[model samples]
Target: MDLETVMQELEALGKERMKKMYISNGAHEPLFGVATGAMKPFSKIIKKNQPLADELYATGNYDAMYFAGVIADPMAMTEEDFERWMDGAYFYMLSDYVVAVTLAETDIAQAVADKWIASGEELKMSAGWSCYCWLLGSRKDSEFSASKLSNMLDQVANTIHHSPERTKSAMNNFIYTVGISYLPLHEKAFETAKAVGPVEMKREKKKSSILLASENIQKELDRGRLGFKRKYVRC
Candidate 1:
């Protein structure tokens, strides 16, 4: 689909309630506030249009940018394209869930994620951590190094508490990702989660509790979903 048509459709799909919710969650203006459920059918329609996704993201409209992430082919995207996407990715849903998840599917996932996590930029670092976390969910144990994973987990255990606001939240997610997705590291992740305890995040002037990594891991365990890898990081 063309950018104009997608924008028009997003406009038609948007709702005041959704817009208010996005605003409350720290999204900037120029948003259509089309719900994810509402966007799914539309996103599926454009899922293979790489050029169109690029145009949509460049528009800088919140809904369009999100749709861009939903449809873009990471394998076809250049590193420069990802950098440009990160530059405009302000909201967590856009940065972490959409951009990060899409990037995780690329051949450059590790290199990009490592660089991003180490970046001084808050959004970039958060996106990087999230990218790595989702990568764990998407890949099998045989595809990566156990020692390297352990070292990264150790690093998070030591530094997550002192990390930047969004990075801390992402780090917390990393622990949960490790706990549930990597069976051998489950004990280590549980220990790290216990060490970190509950994560505190400020949302709309209130302290919101991000689930403890151990608790989330246990929930997965109880549901018999531990060690079950996702087919893809997106969605």
Candidate 2:
């Protein structure tokens, strides 16, 4: 679908509703306010909208503004342009679409590396969380991603006891989804498992191992499950 249609379908308001739902009732206690899911396939209608995202971020609609960076392929943008977009990417963007977008087959991985450095918010920093994994996977001479790779890795490592339970579960789901596509990302996902503090991650089976999970909450979103969204939403 076209960017316009995608925007129309995945409107920030819709995401806001989901975000609110997760925060209010869905997210785990540790992850109560953190995001763990992706822009549902239904949300992918937005093909591209870096310009509009700039406008929103400029206007302080941070949620939507950050999403622009998440959806846009970093390669499609100019170096300077990407630097600017990364500047507006809200720190929390990583909790949702940003991580998936960054690790996805976007052209801006290098530019993202540059921008990741520009914004230096320490403590449970999302940029580093995924960037470290990406760096561990592949690199353009290990310069671009490796450039700021160490710093972000430190940010993620330094972050202890940051995520909650529900957030961890959702992250597990999302990471598994990301892994299904790229084997390398699977190893990178382990970074998240490690970042999740020992005390916080109660289950011995790592969060990245979804197959080993309880499978209760995922059934809510799983279409194959008897009580899918249709049945569960009604009840």
Number of clashes recorded per candidate: 0, 8
lDDT top scorer: 1
lDDT of 1 by residue, 1-235 (tens): 6778889999999999999888887787899889988888877766677899889888888888888888888899989888889988987878898789889889998888888987878789899989988888889888777888889899888887677788888988888988888888888888888988887765557676565777888888899988979886777
Give per-residue CA lDDT, model 2, range 1-235, as digits (tens): 5445534544433545555654443232222121223443433555555655445334333334445544554445565654454454434443333442443335555445444434444312344334433433343332333324334334434433455443343334434332232333333434543444343444334343232222332332254432111111000
Q: What is the TM-score of each candidate against the true structure?
A: 0.95, 0.41
Clashing pairs in 1: none
Error of 2 at 120 (Å): 4.9
| Pairs that clash in candidate 2 | 6-45, 6-46, 28-166, 30-164, 31-164, 74-108, 75-107, 75-108
Q: How many pairs of residues collide in model 1?
A: 0
